[model samples]
Each structure stands twice: as structure tokens, then as C-alpha cells.
Target: MTHNSIRVHYGKRVVAALFGLAVAWGTPVALAEPVDAANQYLGVWNYDQPDRADATDIATVGQFGINPLTFPQVGTIEFTRGRDGEIIGHTDQGCTWHFRVNGDALDLTSTDQYCFNNVIGSGYNTYSWHVTVRDGREQEVVRANSYLGYGTFDFELTNGKRTRADAAGPGDAARLFTGTWMFDPTNPAYLNNLTSPGYQPKTGAVRIDSNGTGLIARTDDGCTWTLDARGNTAELAPAGQTCARSDGTVTMAFWSMSSDGTHVYTVLNSTDPQLGSYFIGSGSLTRQP
Candidate 1:
């Protein structure tokens, strides 16, 4: 198989492992007050890594075929101030932890465990997080020990208080996405497997018209686009039209952009497993001048 195909297969396995780990971590901790000495860790803080992509170590594989390095950028983690003044953290990835903070040192242990049979084989796993926050930044160490193997990941964080503008609903699409956008070949979000045959272009440009229509090169000529004003999310799909792919005809294949209007977050797979092997690709696209 090709290099991209290998990555795609591994990527699927990694995603499965992430969900398994999240399920194993159990539910969020209930609100409680922390000791007088540990109240400083309260409130939501954002993970910040100036060199996140570069910091990720893809060489080592953890349990369930996951790489711990990418965890920081994948989801949000928020710490809320409990009524009693305790530090409680909730992660968008479905895990929660209770904090025991002492000055700059902190300890966090998972409240649950999960087992699964994955690419890394069948096994059970547990997690623990240790962190230190100071001087407008935090350093965190996550340890994942499983029956298969043990892995550690480090992350940094800074305050991420939302401003009045950020909390506001989506702005006009013409202002947010109607422009020239180019896909970044080096930072692909997802790629097609080799079994899926297609001309997967890594470098190309696309234009979103002012009236919610998209014109992309080397793919479907055009498609109807919709943007949710409430959430800055956008979707591009042929809708009623059928688009041709290398393996088969696709009518529902679409690309979904997250709240970030600048990047394409996901691309629906075009391949029909029962029909045969054919996969589509997805990746981030940056606006061009």
C-alpha cells in the first residue's frame, strides 16, 4: 500500500482508540469545592501550543493505535468553579477529572476505565494527568497505561476567555468564506485508503461565491453551500445533483466546515463498502489572497 494509504488505515484506528479511551474515562466529576489552597486552578483554560503540529510525535503508537501527541488540538477542556470552590475539569472528548492543586503543582486521576479490541489488539486502559500552571501558562502531562503498552503526552495551555465578539453568532458568509481558498498539502486532515481508487488532489483551490455556491477545481464543478448563522459552520454538497467519483456515483458526499470558516473540517466518505473499495479524501483548506 502507499504511504497515504497506510496513514489512512492508521488514522481510522486512532479515531476508534480515542473514542474507546473517552468511554473508558467515565463521566465528568460532580461539582465540589477544592481546598483553600487549590482554588487557583478554577475556570476554563485553553490548550495552547505554539508548535502543535511540530510537537506531535507520530513515530510512536499507543494503545488502540492512537498517538497521544494530537490530543491537545482535537478537543476543548474546560475547568469550572464548583459551588464549594473546587476545580473541576470537563473535556469535550467525554472525560472528566477532579483536580488537586497545590500552588503550581497539580494532580488529576481518571475516575473510570474501559476495555476494547482495536488495531493494537484487545486491552484495558487507564489515564492520569499531572499539570502545573503559572505565569499565564500551564504544562500538562498525560499518562495512558494499558494492557498493551504505555504512553505519555505533554500539552501546554494558556487562558482562553471568550470575548464578546467570539461569543457572537456567525457573520456573513461573503465576508467569512467567499474568497479563494487553497488546500494545504502538508497538513491533511484525512486521506483516502488505497482500496479506494480516485484522483485525490492534495493541492487545489476553491472559491465560495457570495450566494452560497462553491466552485472547486479537480472535483465537482460546483455545489450548493449553506452556512449556519448561529454557529459559524458551513456545508458544501451537490444536494439534488449527482456527482461522479472514480469508484461510483455520489449524491450525498459533502464537506462540512466546523465553526471555523477558514478550514474544511470533514469530508463525508464517498465509498460504498458493500459496492467495492473506493475512498474519498478530506483536509483543511486555508483562504488564499
Candidate 2:
């Protein structure tokens, strides 16, 4: 099908026509590229360059070091269904790539380079990635167009151990926090009503630690919190700020996940009368690799 025709059919349902005469039994429907191979790479894969290459030195890889063929700057890659239902990847740094299964190999290329160039320092350069699944772990090869001309370097994409998310059974709220998480407790909005004039929202990563007891969360500014219990709540003291006449001080409380696993609901009581008292708000959280 033409690319334009495919784009037009995006998100549209294709109805199956049943055959009455012959029963086609046990044949699985063919799945589009990356989606079929999603299990091969959806989770985290530790990344490393053999002797520490330029890609590793320049880009931001995630905690588990996703994009092992690239850098160690710790970043994340999230997979979702595209308009055509193909596997689409979105990263924490704001880059998007698409994968297509070629024979027994999974091939992918960067479709969007926004974060790649901005955060990763890799410009419009498109690197072709071919990953082959082995008995235990998969092997990856990354080749730049420049390298293709000489036919010399197939910079081996570092392949590492892959880890999948833990299963938390049905109806468990803790499951929501099971994946990686972060939050910003220092948001100026956390300050009590008296000290600050308005409300500021906190930001950062949010995750439930392996022990299943600690809540690891952080903000964009790097302020971090590790909650030790399941139901405990704590008020945040704003980290001193350089913004207003005083160091930003925030007075906010944080509660654990509710039973349904949907929101990070919180109440912020600002010191500034103009901003009002006891502001209630909530944020939606998604699972991260």
C-alpha cells in the first residue's frame, strides 16, 4: 500500500470476513513490525560502549541505559502503538523511533530527531539498527550512513541484560507505582500560604523500589524523596529558592497511591493568601521502563 493510503487507513478498524467453506485453523494473524517484536525490547536494556565511544560520551542514556547502541547518559524508551498499530518508541529525552521487523531481525530507525539532536547531541543523522535475537540475549548492530560508505564499521550496539516489569496481580494499587517514578518536591507551589504568594507544582520521576517498600520520586531540579511505607504521608519543605526575595520554601504533603492506582492526588496549602489555602490537585502517572 502507498504511504499516503496507509496514513489514511491509520486508526481505522479492518473487519475480518469469515469463510464458511474452509476452516483456517490455528494460523496466527500477521502482526506489524515492531509491535510483534515489542517483547524483545519493550523493557530496559543496559547499554554500554566497549571502550566508551563518542555516542556514550555525548548522549543521555537512561538508568538502565536504554539505547545500548548509543550512550550511558541514562534515559528511558517507552513503546506504544502508532496510528497504524505499529510499535512506536518514545523516550524520556523526547526522541521517537520506529521499528520494523525484517525476517528474524528487528530493524529500527529514528523517525523523529527532536530530542536526539537537542538532548542527545545527535543531529539529523539516521543510524540504522539491526538486532538479532539469540539463545539468551539479543545482539545489536548500529551503522551510520557515513560508515556505510566505507563498509568498515558496524559499531556494535552494546547489548545487555533485559529486565521486565514485575507483576502485581489484579486490582493492586501498588502495581501503579511498581515501574519507575519521579516527582519534584521542591516546586515553589509547595510553600505554605504565608511565605509565598502563589502555588507552584512539584515535578520529577516516580517509581516503586524493588523491595516494594520504598517510593523513589524526584523533580526536574533533582530534589528527591524516598518514602518508606505504603500509606504514610509527608509534608514537603520547599528547598530554598533564588527566585523571590527568599529561598523557595514549600510546605506540601504527599500521600501514597490509592487503591485503584490512578492518580497522585495532593493538597497544597500556600502561605500566600492571594493564591489561597489548601489547593487540591492530582496528576496521572504512567509506567516507565
Question: Which candidate ranks first by lDDT, i.e. highest?
Answer: 1
Local accuracy of candidate 2 as per-residue lDDT tens digits, 99-176: 766677766745332223332123333366565656634455544421222232223334432212222332242454
Native-to-model Cα distance after best TM-score fit, residue 27 in candidate 2, in Å:
19
How does residue 239 of candidate 1 score in lDDT?
A: 30
Off by over 4 Å in 1: 1-39, 49-72, 82-86, 110-126, 146-180, 186-284
* Model 1, residue 162: C-alpha shift (Å): 13
lDDT of candidate 1 over 105-172, digit per residue (tens): 66653434443522123343335556666664555655444453344323222222221122333444
Q: In model 2, state the lDDT of residue 161.
A: 22
Q: How close is candidate 2 to the true structure, as a TM-score?
A: 0.35
Worst 10 residues of 1 by lDDT: 157-166
lDDT of 2: 0.38
